[model samples]
Target: MTITPETLIAAAQSSKAWPFQEAQRLAKRMPKGKPGGVLFETGYGPSGLPHIGTFQEVLRTTLVRRAYEALTGGAPTRLVAFSDDMDGLRKVPDNVPNRDMLAQHLGKPLSRIPDPFEKFESFAAHNNAMLRDFLDRFGFEYEFVSSSECYNGGKFDTALKGVLSNFQAILDIMLPTLGEERRQTYSPVMPVSPTTGAVLQVPIEVVDAEAGLIRFTDEDGAIVEQSALGGMAKCQWKVDWAMRWVALGVDYEMYGKDLTDSGIQSGKIARVLGGHKPEGLIYELFLDGEGEKISKSKGNGLSIEDWLQYGSEESLGYYIFANPRSAKQLHGGVIPKAVDDYWQFRAALPGQELDKQLGNPVWHLLRANESHAGANAPGSGDTLPVPFSLLLNLVGVLGVGATREAVWSYLGNYVTNADPAAHPALDALVDKALAYNRDFVAPTLAKRAPSGGEVGALQALDAALADADPAISAEDLQTIVYEIGKQPEFGFDNLRNWFKALYETLLGSEQGPRMGSFIALYGIAPTRALIAEALAKA
Candidate 1:
């Protein structure tokens, strides 16, 4: 289908997806034909190693930028991945080594501290490299900004001077938000200790705005005075946030919900420094397997690399596409569904309305035009004949890391006229299913004896299969499982439970493809023999 500008723009403006809608909203809010084009920023703090949560900020920003460009006839857009490496190391994370070594150097700028991993110049460099590596692996189009270089090189000089000049005004913006205790010690520009090279959070007793200088008592109680512009001192998080916008003119940005308070304060500070705040959005945090909020410093979630090992990059993109405002899980268990959901979305696209087709997540995942839809949509056009769950069951039968030839061989043995080699989606499904089994679905599974109720269900299934022809459709097999679940003597009151019994007893897992479909593919004789073995154990 030809991608007319009208369909694409309408879909972007009216979509339920947050990124698409946000891009439309923010684009309209941009100055009527501004000279600077569009700039989107994703900020990261180098306090700990980059995690899965870090990807959301950049990915979400990229999505919105893409939407904006698509809607505006491919307008120029640039994404800046900014790292706040100049920030101080408040505490050492438990994930890395040399905690004691880092703890001793707490309160120092991140760039001033030695690398606990000893692979980079400093702790900040080590963490920043990790963030870059992740972005590179995904082939993201973005520019990297180092706060340390920007500050130390005088790139932030103008903003810093403006902040110092309007010190009192910015303080009034921040002081009202702080507690009595915090207000007393707060200074917008925190000074790095001259003696220890530590970032001092102590109150600034004097500010010579005219001379671009500030004085504060060091941790040792000695008075230290320094120039604020040449990286002698750095703005606190809130001030730094505003300073970045003023210097770079970031058009859009986002942060976690927990930082809303600081965000508001920083916006006020930015206005005081003669700059408007970036268009800001809030996203809900990701939780761990146990449902606790994922934290970079706490190390409470899966690493980005870990997730990628068991799932495709497209799966991760689906997770990001989910409710942007609701707390969600980032575990391996979500990976399989993410993969399946993308397939489902693509499978429904071809016959959809122009606007609907344009808004499909598959298009955004491909990051391409509607005419280029062929690039990412899985399967032949929109007819997705196989279920991903069924392919997962194949993973179990064939085992992990099975070759393409082996998978095709297995398919040929069961399903008539099957050509797994020609199926574009088969190989990926097998890989994901095995990874899901190993990383999320395998550990909780164990050998178990079938219950009496399920024994009847299995016997019923066996009798039905005994009379069945060698060839069967997935739909036919599904109907057989449902009919068996309805028999009174079986006591398989719920059809769902009956399916669970089949998966657990026969497949040794809690979930599987439709029973009829699985049985048909595995061949009626082999399926019946497996059920017989399960019944013998019972």
Candidate 2:
């Protein structure tokens, strides 16, 4: 179909892709009379190294921004990767170095603490640079915003004054949520200690709303009067979140589902500051393999490096794109399926209708940069003749520590066009598959004893394979296996059982690549030997 603006907008309106749905919500909530188009923002707390969660939020928000732009016929839009470096360093993160040095600076803003890595001027600066570098590596289009820069450079001066003016209103919204002791000491304004240079979390009184001044006790046991604006103080997290929305004119942002209550409270504070809260999405948090919520401190989830080691960057993006609302288990075990599924989606995109294409994750992923992250390079996409799972199995049979050249040579036998130099994407897949097979698949390889019926089936299959053509296609080989299973003397109840036996007794896994593909790639003679070996063990 010929895709036009009208058709694009119509598809976007009906598309069930989370990003498009979010974009439609943003379109409805956007304010009038603003010459600047919508501003999309994703906030990051620069307390630990940027994790997969960080990448996911930015990627998802970027997708929504692209969808919004498409729905508006290329309306000007900006995405801000805002960092909250000004947040206080409550405790030393377990994952960072120089824990003793970090502990000494606890209660100070992250931008003020010395860099534990000793690379940047401050701890937060080191983290912020890492975040920017990470995002830049992915070719993401965004403007990096620093809370410290905004606060110190007077960008938030006006909003800080607005907070002082609405102090009691914010108090009314926040006090009920706090415990009795915390309620007594809670203040929207968190003044910086004059002597200690740490953020003071003491009770404070609003001195003059119009003058933007507040009175509080410093850690030095001295009463001090300071302007609440111009970096002298910052609002607590919920308050600061609201102030940011008002200050930066952010139209859209997304947060983890754990922050839903905080979002609601921030929304009220945003209105109290005379600006509406941005349209927001609260997506489910990722869980570790054990079903516990992933935490940076615990190091319980897969990091960006961990995922990339076994899969393409595009695969990681696709995994994040598939489901935002549903909690997903992020771990090493999920990588193979994610990689294969990502390629499958790309392979299927060309055959889909426009609306379906719009909904496909690959379509959205390709919208920004078709070849971003070294994925889907020339001669790739649908042209990749093999699934990652198939290559993985090939590597498994080839044994751990198999070289790329060895696997390439084996693949060339089954596919004429399988050249590592020509298919860069497939070459990359080869590298990833080798790594996956070595790390995850090889350790679990064990040939179980075949059952009596499976032995009979394997014996018959070995005989059939001995007479089969060596140059048979994978499909033909699969048909031969199927027909043998259908014979009455084999005593197979179902094809699934037959396949299960093949995997458990031959491949040593409960699941495996298609037997036809495996046989074709491993060669007819080797497959016959594998069947004989299983029969020997029986």
Candidate 3:
């Protein structure tokens, strides 16, 4: 049940989730006495808003790192996120507030786009910073590298020379993949302008160990020249992939299935460049509920920020960790429900077996719960009874403004039936819900206005309640309310329908929590006064 690196590697090999044959070949090339460490790198192209797919990639990489750590008996691993911000923007993303400005920046480096949030200097920095925050929220540790910085730092010089030496090999591979015209458009490392057909050139020079500079001629016999610092490797996309793999010393990386062909070419290019072949894993694509690829350009994607607002951290973790590694589409909305179910399943299974089943990532989540549970603050307890949609529905039906705490109380008391007395863990869960509401939940509960007839019915009920003697016990009050509701003209069904109408008028929703129970808990006096006020306004 305790997943170790060996077990994970075996599982991956059995599942064919990664290139096991290539992994083995690479393993043999590893230096002795130096245990081969896992390195997971996710590439982000900063052309638009970061979406759920980007989160998916990082989450998976974190899971892999955790799994590898467990396997290697706590050996160190590297998780790096590379931002391709140096690349020119190919097209302006839709829904960008400053489309006109962004379009003007098109064909320019992403590092040049003015930051929309005005917090960072450029759009790429803003997006990268957001990505870092998102990863931090998930408890991932990563070293972030920007393409602009890497290139400017001259980190790719050696790799660039290797690429230039293997330029013929690259053309031999790429020429077959691309038509003759496309092949001609490529240089040894860089690409010519597609439209202008001009050979784009870079300045190059050599430097010594003490940082002394020397200008150099092109390895391909071109007349191009530049300073030593400018000698850094800058290549077309595929060659860039090959050089980066060698330069960064990456050992393992996973890509989306859509990029499988490109990954294969990169692998070949790496071999041609005489670098160690990095292990590659391919994960399935994510799809929205409607079965389409989530795309930012099409305005058909969800962002991590949006998901976190409506979902639990555990839910997000489960979405990235529990799913199969094969290519397939995932439903975004089902993620939270799935996480809740996973917790239930873990709770139901025996300890040792459950530990075995959920693996290291889930165990880590449970540990996070244990570490933070006791420190939770008082008055911070409350969570939704069911899903957010359900809570929104209940708020609609109650005809009363409800706080997150109110909804949490209802959910714990009714829907999930989580007994705070029997299950003390439910308190921490409730606290987490309260935190979520405060930090992330959107105010979508107030969507409708009460109608005249609905207000009148509520006013009548309130007047009756106010006239009746106020009872000390909640049970006594509930009995009186039921008695008033049982009248032939104002029966329970009619009263319930009236309440539902009020909800629809106020919230634009038909269904919600039980009416009588909701009123009893929230208090009849406030409920009555709210109704009367609505009637007065009408």
Candidate 4:
């Protein structure tokens, strides 16, 4: 049956994780008049292609938002995918080819990196644009915020001021957490200028409200100063989380389990800085086909692009929604298997439940199926196909054309069951087709080439057909064969053998579908011509 936001939320609350309950606790403390919203942030390092892990975060957040919307019967909660492009180039990623160039741009804002494609204004923009494009393809509506924009806009001024005022407090909290040796070098934040390695011993008077500048004294007691524009934010990485919650008014956020400890640190800092803790939801990591973490920087990861080429969007959605949002590991290569299972799930759902699933965004497979079904007839607007058999049958005939519309039409007419609601067998067939499409590559039609056995079978079939009525149709030919097979010597096994012999003679294969149906679709004359060609080759 169709799963709604309420259902998902209920599921989450019932599960051991209880994210919704956690969200409720946080929601109760928020300002009474303000609507509760979730702020889902994913960092874009701008070092390499965004892997499937990135999509997982965005997709999960979007699904949660959708569920919220469904439950509230209001506009879905806002989701912002923030790109941390203002962050400096800390180190050259292992997979990036241009280490020297990237290192040359080190300590500079990610917005300043040269575009690898040489088309975008900067490397950050190129990556950001790619991410935006990918999200757009999936119909995700997110507020795109660049870290550069936030820094340049002075949105973090108050937060920065708060951080500075509480610097001693932050130091006290971090000192015990980070031993004294580590705390000495750490000033609660990192400040490295493009022109200098470390701006140490700077005067505290460099704190400019208007210019967003913060100054400090280095170990040598020298005045070292830097502007907030130079990637200097209100707080360090640990403190930044707390500052972001206040600055963006974030209510809910989820992260990978790998960062669970860091999330706790951020939550603690948030309590100190913002007087409130950001709702932190922890999710599990994704593994490759072999159950290993999919690391993009390591040049080993499955991308959304890779999945989309073979799997349907619905399948992807199914992959996301089927599992609990808890810290469960996912197998990337087995995504196809997930998609296949999702189709089966949809097919098995009650009619009304399936209808509901079709209406939900998390049920992307249903949507894809609907889109395919709708495009079946020209000028028919979009409609859903009746059953999976139509799709499989159409694929079997190799009638799936260049356009999705063509494929849809072929499926609607030939593959779908006449009455899916009533026909159990037909419904089962549809499920089988969905499984095949989800798990395996679509089969390609064999090229015409008659083998020696095929030539012999075709000669015998041709002689038989010639002796029979000239007007005998392909269907009639099947009936004739059935009649012959009724003989004790020519039973089902022999009939199968006879058909294989005929196929071998005509098409160079000992296997094929019913000759009558094949001939009817291929045309009697074309069938004869194919056999003649095969005979000539023999």
Ranking by lDDT: 2, 1, 3, 4
lDDT per residue as tens, model 3, 249-333: 8877778888888888888998898875576567777666677876655656456665555556666666666543554344444
Choose the strongest candidate by lDDT.
2
TM-score of 1: 0.88
**Cα-based lDDT at residue 283, candidate 4:** 78
Question: After superposition, which runs of candidate 3 have C-alpha atoms over 4 Å from their true positions?
Answer: 1-37, 95-101, 112-119, 191-233, 324-336, 346-350, 354-361, 364-538
Between candidates 2 and 3, the lDDT winner: 2
Candidate 2 or 3, higher TM-score? 2
How far in Å is the alpha carbon of 43 misplaced in model 3?
Answer: 1.5
Each prediction's Cα lDDT score?
0.77, 0.86, 0.57, 0.55
RMSD of each: 3.4, 2.1, 9.2, 9.1
Query: Which portions of model 2 show Cα errors greater than 4 Å?
Result: 31-33, 368-380
User: lDDT for model 2, on a 0 to 1 scale?
Assistant: 0.86
Give all TM-scores, in the order shown: 0.88, 0.96, 0.63, 0.63
Candidate that would win on TM-score:
2
Q: Counting only residues 3 or more apart in sequence or on different chains, how many pairs clash (N, Cα, C under 3 Å) in candidate 4? A: 29
- For residue 321, model 2's alpha carbon misses the true position, in angstroms, by 0.8
Work out how many backbone clashes candidate 3 has: 7
> What is the per-residue lDDT of model 1 for residues 1-538, given as tens digits with 9 covering 90 to 100?
6657776766666776666778767877872325667888998888876667677787777777877886776778788899998988886788899999999988888887899999999999999999898788776788899999999999998888888889888888888888999998999888888888888788884467767788889889988777887778899888999989989988899889999988888888888888887886798888989999876667677777777676666767877877688889877677667767877887777667767765677767667222344563333644334555666676665445555566556566454456655555555555655676555555565546799888878888899888776666767878988998988888877888888888889888887777776776666877887888788898
Q: What does candidate 2 score on TM?
A: 0.96
Mind sharing the TM-score for model 3? 0.63
